[model samples]
Target: MGDVFAAVPGAVVDETGLQHLGNPLAEQRRLAAGTALAPRADRAVIAVPGEDRLTWLDSLSSQALARLQPGVGTELLILDPQGHVEHAASVLDDGETTWLIADRADVEGLYDWLRKMRFRLRVDPRIADEFAVIGGTAGALAGVAPASPAGLPLVWTDPWPDVSPGGWAYAPVDPHPGADRDWSEAIVTRDEEARIADAAARGDLQLAGLAAVDALRVAAWRPRWSADVDERALPHELDWLRTAVHLDKGCYRGQETIAKVHNLGHPPRRLVALQLDGSGSVLPDHGAAVRVGDDEVGAVTSAALHYEEGPIALAIVRRSTPIDAALTVETADGPVAAAQEVVVPPDAGRTANVPRIPRLGRRQASQ
Candidate 1:
């Protein structure tokens, strides 16, 4: 069970064999301090170049990509014709071309989709394995600005300025000065999996495990592709108007539906954060029914025992459900008392005012 143990928090420490008892924050700090181990996941990079690259990608994705300048990057969502999210990616422009870094699983499919749509465009898309990607906290990334090691602007592009506040930089794989590297991806022929793992263990860079990363991401209310989205999900439902949809931008695949829903119609569902009552033995799973009294109002999409908070979750609840109403999350163990905590409220874009909800209290209760 050491492998599974290594996968979860408060399990294993670093190569020094130190163990984290039960403190998530301590583990996170240790991981950040290079004392604990963080798992590295697979990533892929796709390169797009030519005269029509920016316009072509802008036409394809929901964000306004054509306006992206070098030394900047943006997160975008690709939706099907039905307005359902298909994939999410970050695009970095290097003045001449753009590079999309996304999950390894979705790379090939995204490439195929882009190829199918490249009718007469002068753009060329190909996989680039020469580069690697790493991430760190805002304070850790001080002097690392995006520049090409190859002297080719196409090879090194700054994808951090536009999206992140000012702490992340994506650079080349070769050695650099004062860099605490996390994960490195080499080409198939020159794979350096063991070396990277050993370096991570040696405290050179912090390892961001999937659980810690997911916890931070969910806490930030960032919508991911597979976890928070699906085939039937609309961009507006996830509160992705600011990042995913360009309301004033020209036509795209599902622009009509998006416009109509935003201007005239209401989104059927809204994404919300739920704070569990902590009294029940049950923990809800994805697709579990969400209820208010006797009415089934929504479904739970994601849940976790937060690092600080006891139990929290993200659920897609019906718009009709009273925003302040008490709801219940049906878990296998039993019905867990929960209340709705709106991360991004329905009127978020309309007004600068945001309503604050009380935090949920947890205690063991009888079934």
Candidate 2:
């Protein structure tokens, strides 16, 4: 069970005083307002443009970018020579330049890598935090236009509105009315704090704590780098080939390795969903063993008690494990039956007929 919302006179407080509820009525007002907005965390934006921008980027990532249109975005995987995923990002193009938004932790590494690879390319890659991103399901953003919500640049709207199914939009925060009034950002100025507190009292948007956000993401099967990937993971192994890899794309640093595994061999492992049986102890953290009988087949990468699906997890299991079979996930306490819910269908697995870049080298060693 999670912590309860304590009703404290005019204010709402949790057991921990750290979160001082400003006003119950106002919070309730915002909840009733029902304007859905979710924060996009662990993302950094890198802007790139120049005479050689497209070719430079295309030569680096696992996706084909020669055809990426303006006002659209595509997911890409940056890989090491060994084909291990170094980082992943959502790349957006404005026709003139491309912006790469990746996990916050990987931004530095990515920036450094891009800098090193800037040889003779007329592209510039730099971190820009002036833009803030807020998103929500399409239905919630139905009425909002591409214009700035308040005064911030509505730089762009979700081009593939139907891709996420439920839909979502990312907009800057400054122009968003009352968005700056919360203690969410770490570097808010004193003057901004009072203004934001006042805005909070006026019943603007409901602030969803990180816990609620985490639960929502897990339910959506949205993979997170911290929970779902590591240095040992390959782009294909994370079930990102469809979204991250461009099968027909030309040569890149790791293209040979990627094409080899994708077209000619099975990836070492496959990412799958694990539905925990029964109301067990809180799902174990990442790296807990997943066993088929007594033999360990894989480990849990992410786990949570979904609001709709009870206990569920995402794990990278051995490719040999039967897709339709049931397995046991080993928690600290003991083994618990976890039924496999295949997210990346087996047919889409690496063994399938993934288009290859002709005459690539042989497959790399499996993990």
Best by TM-score: 1
lDDT of 2 at 41: 40
Cα RMSDs of all predictions?
8.6, 11.1
Predicted candidate 2 versus true structure: per-residue lDDT over 180-209, tens digit per residue:
122111211224323433443465534433
For model 1, how does the per-residue alpha-carbon lDDT over 1-367 read when each residue is reduced to its tens digit?
Answer: 0122243433454532223435655555554444444332344578888889989888988878777877455666688887778877777777776778776667788888888889999998987655444333433332123235333332222221222331111111122111232311122211333344445445454454545544544544556665777668987776666455667777788877876776666677888877777765456888899998889998888776555555777888887777778788899887877866564455433323444444333322111
Tell me the lDDT of model 1 at 305: 57
What's the number of clashes in each of the models?
A: 1, 3
Candidate 1, after superposition: displacement of residue 255 in Å?
0.9
Model 1 misplaced stretches (Cα beyond 4 Å): 1-25, 29-42, 129-132, 141-196, 203-205, 279-283, 344-367
Q: What are the TM-scores, per candidate, against the unseen true structure?
A: 0.74, 0.71
